[model samples]
Target chain A: MSDHHKETFISKYVFSLDHKMIAKQFLITGMFMGIIGMLMSIMFRLQLSNPGESFAVLEWFLGSKWAPGGILDPNMYLSLVTMHGTILVFWVLTAGLTGTFANFLIPLQIGARDMASGFMNMLSYWFFFAATIILLCSLFVETGPASAGWTIYPPLSALPQAIPGSGLGQDLWLVSIALFIVSSLLGGLNYIVTILNLRTKGMSMSRLPLTMWAILITAILGVLSFPVLLAAALLLIFDRSFGTSFYLSDIIIGGEALHHTGGSPVLFEHLFWFLGHPEVYIILLPSLGIVSEVMSVNTRKPIFGYKAMVGAMLAIAFLSFIVWGHHMFITGMDPFLGSVFTFTTLLIAIPSAVKVFNYLATLWKGSIRFTPAMLFTIGFVSTFITGGLTGLILGDSALDINVHDTYFVVGHFHIVMGLSAIYGMFSGVYHWFPKMYGRMMNKKLGYLHFWVTFIAAYGVFFPMHFLGLAGLPRRYYTNSAFPMFDNLTDINSIITFFAIVGGLVQLVFVFNFFYSIFKGTKASENPWESNTLEWTTPVERIHGNWPGEIPTVHRWPYDYSKPGADKDFVMQTEPLKEGKTEH
Target chain B: MSTSKNNTSKQLLWIAMAGIFMFFAGLTSAVIVRSAEHGWDSIDMPIWFWYSTAAIILSSLLLIIAKWQVKKGNSPSIYVLGALALGLFFGYCQVKGWDQLTAMGMYFVGEGSNPSSSFLYVITFAHLVHVIGGLVALIITSVKSLQSKYTKDNYLGIELVSIYWHFLDVLWVYLFVFLLYSVK
Candidate 1:
């Protein structure tokens, strides 16, 4: 095939090795998966709101067999909750958010043409796609999806007869997670090598954008952490299929003694949470980095304390590894280790506080654009703050005991990980929509998307704090078993109503995402007016990022509103002005 | 740029080699931890396994010599023979190791002995499985040497294969020492 013809639809769109196309694929798939996860949460919310009410909606969607006469089955509720959390957290957040942005931005922002291994980059997405399919397949299993919690804690997960969902659905869950971990490993390896080896001429590590720093450290965490999860999955597989008890012992299944003689479930928790804790930041720091990039540009001010911002990020990443025990304080862990974990966990707040302060400080007394991208950045910082402060509450060993499995924990994490990351995803879509699609998203719909989502998200989660304070436990199919929980039904109903609206508000954003791709206003070449190198390239993305010899970097990416600069911002590849510090 | 290109490729191969090494190291750590738990089982070390370990060490020597012959611009007929002998030696050692485990009543994918022993066999066998890929590379490197694709200044291809082969040798030694000291 001629070079021109060789670049046909199959090569360019489907099997294309360009990182940008791959990133687009990740974004689109993540949105699709995110909708599924969000819709499940809304469905569960409805059930929680009106327990013992008609199961008509679920039955209509899940079929009469699943709903069982318009009443949501307890097993189905647990299954949906498990799969919902699984998809949003792992499938959407880690792979979709981190994988896409890391692939696209790492090479571009770091000044490489493409990933270190473009073929492997393509394989990484396909593997993630396959894993997503396997996870979706669990929803169709006859016995139902994995109901053993998202953590898949054993004894519950290990015994075949522990719950009906454990029969085939838990098996599928393990297989899906194992596959996802492999996909993550492959992707992580490429990110590490590309950033380490493929930087553009003159783009040193210190001069790199904070986004690159976040991705680099996050990739390192994935590399060091994911294998432990693979190990955990393999052991669980051995227990499930091969009858080896690496993670189970002394459990009676259906009142019969299990063959598993001597194993520790705590070991599995240790391994799972080793990957699990870093995973929270793995989903978080990249979004934080994006907000940093967007905020500085929109404000047209040099990011306040660039060094301190990067330092806080590094501090957060370093501290993320040790706080796994906070998740397990109520898992009956040794009380002494709780202090160790609580201290590390709460210490995370200091750096996190520094980041939030830096963002607000950047916005302080500066020219700030309320563009949808900027709006989402502000939304992220807002949610990040509201969500992050309560983390200190749950981060405390004593306070966590009161609210461990309560909706407080749910509200805290959802605000931080859920809303914060999704806002990050949206901010990127609006900020780089011009670059990615060569068109601008409709600002009217974009703002509407921002306001509705912002309000509905708070409206949904804020009541959750009340329910938590009212001592409502999470993962309960119906809390009617306890008479004391009856008073909180009003709060559950209010939150559920808000959750449905929140779920629906995302439709506006989704419509904008697709509609804007082909039909929105034509974007200026540098729509966000940022100093990042990506804007220096052609609007029409090509296989090699630049058309000629690579552009050389001459300044830092966050150079906004510097003294004696002709423009408020400076392009990374521009020659330095006469007499000034580079930054 | 061209020379560094090949070295970068060599560096990539090194990273991949390190990746494979990490898998084995994790497996060994699992083995140590799993066996220390309750209901532990210990099995006698197989006798022929010692001989296989010795044979693999000797094969590393032959691989080095084979690479050296290609470097010296000599006809590699002797090196080819030595490499073939070493490849066969390594494969033979792997089978004998399995057989010796069988003779000692340890089995992978079977009921006899604890799963810990099965894990030992699996980890070692898995490492050997990856070594087969390396062995194939050595064969291709031997053949490429015959075609004069490498010279003293541009011998990164041969050098990389030899380095990976040596790593496998060292990795196997580490596994052996670990199994020897930790299992009993």
Candidate 2:
């Protein structure tokens, strides 16, 4: 720990093993990836909205190759959409949200000196950085990026000649993803080990903050699921490179019969969804956990049903594994299997409902404060409820048959998993910025960012349900291809407008984040006056979290507004009186 | 940070091993499901795989002996070297088994290959990669053992490596049985 102060610039800022520095790295990189992913979405949305209209902005950004004479090439349209999903899901949400907060808060909140293994932590970030470089580099390839949609289903992804983007671009996508998986596994292993092994003396599991519990479960989900995705990616790589027929089958492409036979694309789908379904939870649970913490802190109440909230998270983690089949109900899977998936998928809603009720109960009749973090957290609950309710419609096998791959399904997931998680991430960022940077973010800008983002997020995704019910399929380059979708044109434009507004609002967050790091008002050590152990530490970042002996926790993290307390909030380190009982 | 932290690391190692187990479980499940689908071709088990399995088991046995020797406060260099030698031999046998499969018209790719053979190569090769990782650990342990780093009072590194080695051995056996039964 003493050697930490003598760290050189390269060691301290670049290739650093300190968990706090690594967390900042993850945050910055994730923000950059988010920008790219968002811009890609805007590009495609512009195409979807105007159809035949040419935008010089597209040509200016994408160049003549992708947006020739301003109209986005159809292939490039698919490429943008595919890259958008891939970047957002894996790079931004999974890595950015989980990687950033897990690295920052896990050590601070748990009262540990640093991660269990700092060297492996450094390796994790470098691997992720390499993956990010490779993925972004793929966009510069001559044939464009992998355009077979983010799912990259087999026949399209397997054959290089199947699509122009499938050539070298898909290979890079696989390689980049393989590296990303390695990074994620290393990071997940570190998180699990640190959480389980590195907790200070009194930080018992039940007494832990919901954020720590959420991160622990999120790490477990990543550990169990990411490898399955790796297996799927490896087989896909073999099929592409070595002519293995793992995911390839009988197909005559161009004019010749391919050597591939006997491989089932369904197998790829199975392996993918095994990781994929859990992936939604992986992205989501952390945000839910962060919201729980923020909400409890803001409302000045002990979190409602603390035990039940933990139970629901556990139930959700367990149920996430079995419900992968729900995504494949329309792939001609067995009806019995579909029924099983439906039962499991719908069962997940029970725990989810319990969690929502717990949040509302926590907030009910409390001295509520609408900090920026609280605003985003409330927005998270709203979006989570709306998105989760729609999942019931998509989870049913019979109903899914009618709306599979439509905007309805898109709307359900985007709101539930995508926007909600982003909101959760924002809440965490606003809440923890002081801890990370020792400065406060601009509250007015945060509020402005949250309001615009929340309203426009719903404005963007809400009407897509109607478009889906109208039988509008996703991934279409232009809706004007058929007159049946003519009615969707105006709705598409409206969605696009709202999406652009939502995307622009994030710039406010970016400005506030970076600006506050250097110029904002200096934050007090316990600015929020919250009860977490992280607030017990000094504002100045150090190698070992505390300068001296670590504090031993005597109570749960959510002890806000306890009866007969000296203050409204009591820190975790506060010892109980002789007659007092632990909460 | 403390002597108790060693126990936690060991626990973390086991949790990681469980994750790796699930990874292999996923690949093996794919093997089962893909076999049930059309265009299946089964190949006979290579004799070298049996040899590889025996070699890995022997290596695990030697590691157990090494652990016992360390407990008795004796230098375990001989047992450590023996286990390392056997681990390398197991890797050799696996490569030879692949060669045998290649000779028997079972290729991982190209016109001659089937999905079953491809899966066989994949599962075996993937296990081999882990085996190589174990071998690296074994080599380091051997070096440290020869230098008399382990005694009755402290052998956590050796213990951890042995646990991982045994896991690798058991994982290979599970994969072998899985492929053997599913190939038919």
Candidate 3:
């Protein structure tokens, strides 16, 4: 209700209640976390490629304790791997992608002044910040960060005796995750409510941008699924701290009989993957949303098959819940149940194929602008296809048993979920940089960032598939144990080279992002000439998005290249010409 | 800021309730699966649990009456306080129930514990934690009603708290039946 107000620096920037400011907060924090995650990956990549070799950088970053004699300790290697996955998946992709875009676009695109409860949105970012602090603080603990992989499966994650990282680091990991879940739930609730209840006049659910639909569904998925992760993590906490055996059973750690019995780790697996599988979509759907909007704008065409895209995303979200069992197939589940999981898992391919076809069809013969955002959108599709194909192989229970935790699985997820989502985030940052910062990022730097990342991403992950097929299990400190795997050493070295290149290329983006905020070219009101409500607002940031009255949406967001339209793109606020039916 | 005629807070509460439902759904499913495993010792439902269940049910009834009073343009502070009292009573009974289980040699963890008893303690404790949240909302609502912050036409606060309290009440009923059926 209070749109116009004089503000101090603290109210405006630090603890702002404005959704746009909050979105920027999420973005900066996510990028900070992303750099840390990327650095961790490069550290482990070096260790993996050049086993037993000393790296001065590792000692510099990790200090002499974890990297004595400049070589990474075996336990610390697992910590790097674990924190890398945790940070990238949860902090960078899930929180960063949805947290940034959803907050920025939901109000502006939907014609609202702010989130339903601006205070809650601020709390969401602060909670995420707190969670980030705790998780980062975990790395400095005496033992190490949680190292039982990001999955944090127990017996390993449960007992400090099993792994040194399990002691305080795992406890902090659970607490941080619990707070992160709360932050996401708070943000998710606001997203769902604002999108549903705050749309301007004439903006029906069907007429809203695909980004809104994707984000709304993504928020819903987070709401339903993340609590299960909270549940799983809580039980794991009890197992670790309270001497409960929710996951641990019949243990003989250090040649001593434990009092715990009857608890099954499979129960933990069931609960974890329930959230874990949906968590993948929670990371990807926002990107899918952003890509749809970016492709529609850059290609100068209405997104093809809008209804089908909505239906397909819904289908994917629904299937995501059922298909989580595919991740646990090798846990000795019944063959019948595994078959059911396999069937459900592959059914996702249908909707996924529909989405891919829609993106291709949208691009077919359209006047495509080869902007940096468009390049990453195209890259996202490429990696989504490349990574999704391997999913078919991994989804089968019989086939998965052979390579469940191998480098193939690693390659598969990194390409599909990791690369694809990161590309979507980059696409979003480039496309909406003007709206977020009121300035343009350097196009040359953007192009350089996209090209190097694209090549290095494929270079890094594509070879891991072959190594996985060759039976190189993932998360190994060194594959120097068996001479049978000796021949794959060169490929690991190649992958590591690409990995380092990819990790470094992100700096081009970081520099472009920060530099453009202050010194880059001042943006026009609508640089992309997009047909969305967000582009209708002034370039300067304001508490309420629009200066005067919020414009009422008159048509769908995608109205590019309509016949008889004077311009190629039509803003959603424009009245249709007489007898011009809305799309 | 929003011009639409939608009840956003209600929608948010319902969505949050769905998430909370999933949370308990996860815990209950774990209970069923773990009960089928070896070395699970089934424990009887603690006597105080039934009393706590009744307290929460009656607490919901008081909130219903409070809502009715608001609709009639009367102060609902007394009924709201009644609901808060019963909410506190429900929490007390839950602790007593856990105490009763300890007396029965059923423990949450450590020596002489079983997974069945652990699930019981954790699920009920989690529910009680939520009940405490509901009690906090109840306190705020009763205080606001005393200050006449709500009226016949303006009772979103009362309505929201009622919805959440009823959901928790219903949730406890579901858990009670589920624990009765599965925890044995």
Candidate lDDT scores, in order, read: 0.81, 0.92, 0.93
Q: Candidate 2: where are CA atoms >4 Å away?
A: A2-4
Cα error, residue A519 of model 1, in Å, equals 0.7
| B1-184 per-residue lDDT for model 2 (tens digits) | 3576687679778877877888898899899889888789989999999999999999999999999999999988899899999999998999999999999999999978999999999999999998899999999999999899988888987898999999999999999988888876
Clashing pairs in 3: none
Q: List, for all models, the DockQ compared with the true complex.
A: 0.28, 0.72, 0.82
Report the TM-score measured on chain A for model 3: 0.99
Q: Which should have the higher TM-score, number 1 or number 3?
A: 3
Selected candidate, larger DockQ, 1 vs 3: 3
Q: Could you say which candidate leads in lDDT? A: 3
Candidate 1 on B87-148: residue-level lDDT in tens? 66777877887888887787654356465676677667777786788788877877777787
In candidate 1, residue A485 scores what lDDT? 94
RMSD of each: 3.0, 1.1, 1.3
